[model samples]
Target chain A: MSNPSPALVRFQTQKSLAHRLTLATLTGRPVHISQIRPSSPTDPGLAPHEISFLRLLEAVTNGSHIEISYTGTTLVYRPGLITGSSPGSGASGGVIRHELPAGCTRGVSYFLVPLCLLAPFSKAPINVLFTGSGVITSATPTGDMSADSVRTAILPLYAQFGISNNIELRILRRSNVGAGGKGGAGEVHLVFGHQVRLPKTVHIMNPGRVKKIRGVAYCTGVSASNNARMIEEARGILNSMTGDTYIFSDVSSAAYLPSKDKSNPNQKRKTGVGFGLSLVAESSTGSLYSADLASPPAGGVPPEDIGRQCAYQLLESVSLGGAVSLAAATTVLTLMAMGSEDVGRLQLGRDVLGSETLICLARDLKAFGASGWGVRDANTGQEGDVVVSVVGRGVGNVGRKIA
Target chain B: MEKARRMHSTQKKYRISDFARLIYDESLAPAEVVRKWRGEDGMADLADDHGPEEAVEEDENFFRKAKHNDDDGNNNEDRLIPKYDYDTLAQKWSNPENLESLRQRFTTANLMKERNG
Candidate 1:
């Protein structure tokens, strides 16, 4: 291709690579990210997980060009058309599958979250299966980035923006990594149907109080009793908070195959079992928030502690009192900015205003030309809520194939 | 006067070079530079550095907040609910006032006056 125009945006450091990439893909803009931990003593530049994430991005788009400095401290990305499916492949009803053995560093949210933003605009249906140890781990010590969070929190938030149908997330296997366990080995499947109907406006000003709680306690390659014990303890805590509480016990063996035989699981098993708990609380207005905890393979944590910890995390999310959890705000803000041309409004907890993720999101949105944005404290002058407004850029899907 | 305003509007269009300079400028810290770009003076020329101490502090805060999640041991106890403390949390939830405050979230609760009965 002819030499393209210079990059339209530049940032130093390694913050929000996923956000920047997603924005660039949507706007067809080139971005240069530099000084990505250039001064760190040991193993600076892009982490292994980041390189894996970039591979996923390159797989989805056509003609995308990614240039990295030899030192790995700088990156320049020229986005190609978001050809959701491989070129020349007509839209097929069968789900398009992409699998990644995500290194045990970052959780699947690192990839799944951006997919949630891009899938709706894809030309064909897409299914992603991420396998690794840290698929559920979050940057937040107490927060979770599990597939359950995507189902309970992220999907529901997308629904408010008129993306209710054609999306599903399933946790096929649960693997616990880190202390008291083997290492991160789990499996999650996410399917996105083609066609995301953009909303004309979003006005979720009030997130009603949580009404009920539900959850899944899952175990793989571990004792079945582990799942039951976790559910029992977690319910003991949730029951006191609300009458409507239910936690399910799920035991599956498909996620524990040895890495050598992951594809053909008939091979000898070489790994130990894993166990974890995931919880979701639903508010009266249909908002959902979630949390999860996993036990290490060797020095296992008490099932009761895992249960209680997950429950407390759910309670903390509810107490934050927003239509969506702080973690889900990034997706919310991105969708709002990408919606049809009109003002979209969201009432979020004060924590979102101060969150580095949201701050970076605001900066990225400005870079994308959605400059007419504002944040105002709630009218009551209380710390309860903050109202955020942004004018959508009316970004439509250029990759959608004509039926 | 009209010509000047029109010229200023055209210049307001964002360019990658501007963002690069804003970030790489050694004199002003990154956060301060970001603030200026987001401030009312959208694209005004950068001001001279305000000493190294302030820049260092602002830069540290920016990176600290950004790395909050990545640092495994840097736990923000204030934000996390203590694990395994079910009894106290359960008791807190059982409070009558607490239950009442959240009652509106249930279907059995009365609808707002704005909605028709």
Candidate 2:
């Protein structure tokens, strides 16, 4: 094409009053046009209602709308393209079932648009919803009623599934549809979502998963008086986890202090941030002692001292979200990036998530105790309910690398 | 004599901040993952103190005593020591001049030679 004159180029660059009006008509909303020359001094903009009507007409002509009902409440939603009704909807009671018969054209001009507007905002309880008919009968360039009707029919279903929107869906200049004579149809896409929080008193089949990883601070001491100091430190740490703190003693100290190596400092000095690392320095206290974190003792002492306390507890893990072993010692590197200090020494093998590899570790940590694992996929970004069952308690058996 | 004195001073200067970084850096992995792993209260601070600058020499001496000499399976000294501290491993790690000696400090060949000798 020959280079256009500068005046013509400037004219093309400038949006005319008619172009502005058309855009307002298409948008279905009042648009404040500014900074450009008003083509005609007498032409103030189209009336707000008229502009809305024009946009709605364009939407019906080029796009489409779909009203869906589920469990008594009806929802009118629009999609980006004309696909089809969402899965499982077309087969049974769906948007199509709820709509009026196709032949009813009495309100095609005025009432149809009103119905389209009402479908989305309707709060009617819907037990069995069906697709409403006559959602897409509109004027088109080709003027083929049959073609327009089919486009209108398929477009709403697509919109319900999040495919299309606007009854007058426009096909762009380079659209893929061949021989663009009244061939433009909008597509819709849809997805359903629900959210439910766990009950305060959850009925977990096993309590092992219920045990949150605990944070503890302990200073070992032999004498009773010194043992008390350890309790103070442990209690301080535990208090930070949650106000409701408790202490229990098992004949086997291993449950509390997994690495109580009296000889190796690496093992003996197992100052952990998990469940308190404690030893019964004396036998006076007993086997079980619990403390409500919210209500600590007057002297900031652990409410109950079960036995010769070697350490005190402040916090514990309620869930083993995830854990992973990373290459290049990245576990520590990542934690450093997250900001250190808040996380202390990980219980040599405590499970954690959001850092390192969270996908499988959280599930495997479940296997550490009596509970079975619910392994989600390894790709952290992927979503869906994919919990695989592990065979047994997770110690000896190499955990299946669940994706 | 000057070198020995300088060495003694260098040893004394080994603050907890230095050793804190090493242990704290290592602690970061677990600390970051388990939000509660590091105590919400300043525990994460200690975890980050693993850098060499945070090492407290005196603290290390005491921590070493506590780690190596807990009174025969029962050290009941209620003396509070920060959970993590660096030990005076018999290497020249604290001083750059001593790095040459430190380089040979942990070599397998040197270890074998020492054992043979």
Candidate 3:
């Protein structure tokens, strides 16, 4: 292999750590991040989800190396080849089952989103089951969207790049946040059967008018009436705009997990007992805008507020006026940056471009030796839309290159 | 001392821009999500210069005032209810003139446009 020892990319703080690690894995570059919550008096290191994510990366890859400082404030990670679920490398029966500890506060989509970015370039098919107590399948107040939205909104974008076959995100069991917002006992299974050497370069500039709106209203361990109330309230606002609006309802019982009480060794308690709504609007040109809202863990607000607020959020996303919503710009742009050598063009709204996440992602891509993006005003019918042209690194699927 | 001063200056520089990231209000830093929309303040440059004629023409009489129907044998005559009811009454859009006022609205516009002519 050429360039055996590439220079390590240096970063600071825990901001956008997920994207940074994803970029490193995609480009096979090593990263050294410092000052991860250095000043938090009580908890000053990498959070629980971050550690679990590192373990997940190791499970899917062949030879990744992750080293943390003594206080856990600093980390040096050398990315390995994404072996996926091939035989003999920590995968049993062609599937890797990764468990999150009881203390994880993030929703499972927190891990699923970044891991999906790594799937297309893997050497083999990626199949992983995320289970255990910390797997909150619904969106939390932490801004990690629900798994339903991941299946509905985020996965469909891969089809534009031509990597959309046999991919599935099955929410085996639904769960919301448990008491005090710590964890939930949920289970999710993901299968990415399509592995590509290079994703097709895409030039998407048209954000057509949203023609149809679809949603999922789900409640666990709560009254089925909660789902109807959320659907009714959301539809009350959305139905007037788009005639082709339908919200499906899913009601399930809470997950029963074993309790840690020593006195009653056989104790079982129900966890993740709340309701949430995930709404998605699909444009005529296959663009998706999504909104997610769930009842808070403390449980005082009504389901109606969640529905109405989520409907307003969907309107806000549509009003952003771009080919990609703010929630999806990072994924689409990252895939564009890692595509074949030709430049791919994407039209983004002014607000999405000015967002801190996208700006930092562009900078990080340049730091990882990818070419700079060319930004110019798009002359599309929409106002204030800018076209970003990303020249790909042309380095994709090193495992395929070797094999 | 130098490190402390440098940290303070940098913090001041990036205070507002940092809030654009999608992070919940961690108990430590506590950034508030302001629900106060800019539309509530109206358009800044377009607020004072607008004429009153644009306001006078929005006669809420023609639209169907389909909010909170009352059974007290009274109706809001301000919204133009029609004289007679068809078998399939176009109760959808017509507010008649004879029905007495059922309730009063507290909006600023309601003060000027009283019950009926």
- Top of the candidates by lDDT: 3
Candidate 2: share of reference interface contacts reproduced: 0.01
- Candidate 1 ranges beyond 4 A from true positions: A1-6, A86-97, A131-144, A178-185, A254-272, A296-298, A379-383, A400-403, B1-117
* Model 2 bad stretches (over 4 Å): A1-221, A248-276, A279-374, A377-386, A391-403, B1-117
DockQ of candidate 1 against the true complex: 0.09
* Model 3, runs deviating above 4 Å: B1-117
Cα lDDT tens digits for candidate 3, A312-372: 6776577667899988888899999889999999998765675546656777888899987
Q: For residue A212, what is the lDDT in candidate 1?
A: 81
Give the TM-score (vs. native) of candidate 1.
0.74
Docking class of 3: incorrect
Range of the 10 consecutive residues with the lowest summed lDDT in candidate 1 chain B = B73-82
Q: Which is the better candidate, 2 or 3, if ranked by TM-score?
A: 3
Tens-place lDDT per residue, model 3, B6-87, is 4334322222223232222222121111110111111112324645553342223112222222332123111100122221
lDDT of 2 by residue, A138-194 (tens): 221111111122222222322321223334422111100111221111111111111
Tens-digit lDDT track for model 2 on B22-65?
A: 22233333323233222222232443555544345434544564
> Per-residue lDDT for A1-403 in model 1, tens only?
2446755588777767777888988777888999887767887788766777787777677778899999999999888766665435322344334444433445566678888788777666566666554454322233336555667667777667766676888766555443332235556777776466455478877676568888877776667898888888788866756788887777766344444546876765434256678788887777777776666445447887777767766765666566767767778888888888888888776544444456567777787677645666566322346677878887757664233
Error of 2 at A384 (Å): 12
Q: Candidate 1 or 2, higher DockQ?
A: 1
* Cα misplacement distance, residue A345 of candidate 1 (Å): 0.9
Range of the 10 consecutive residues with the lowest summed lDDT in candidate 2 chain A: A195-204
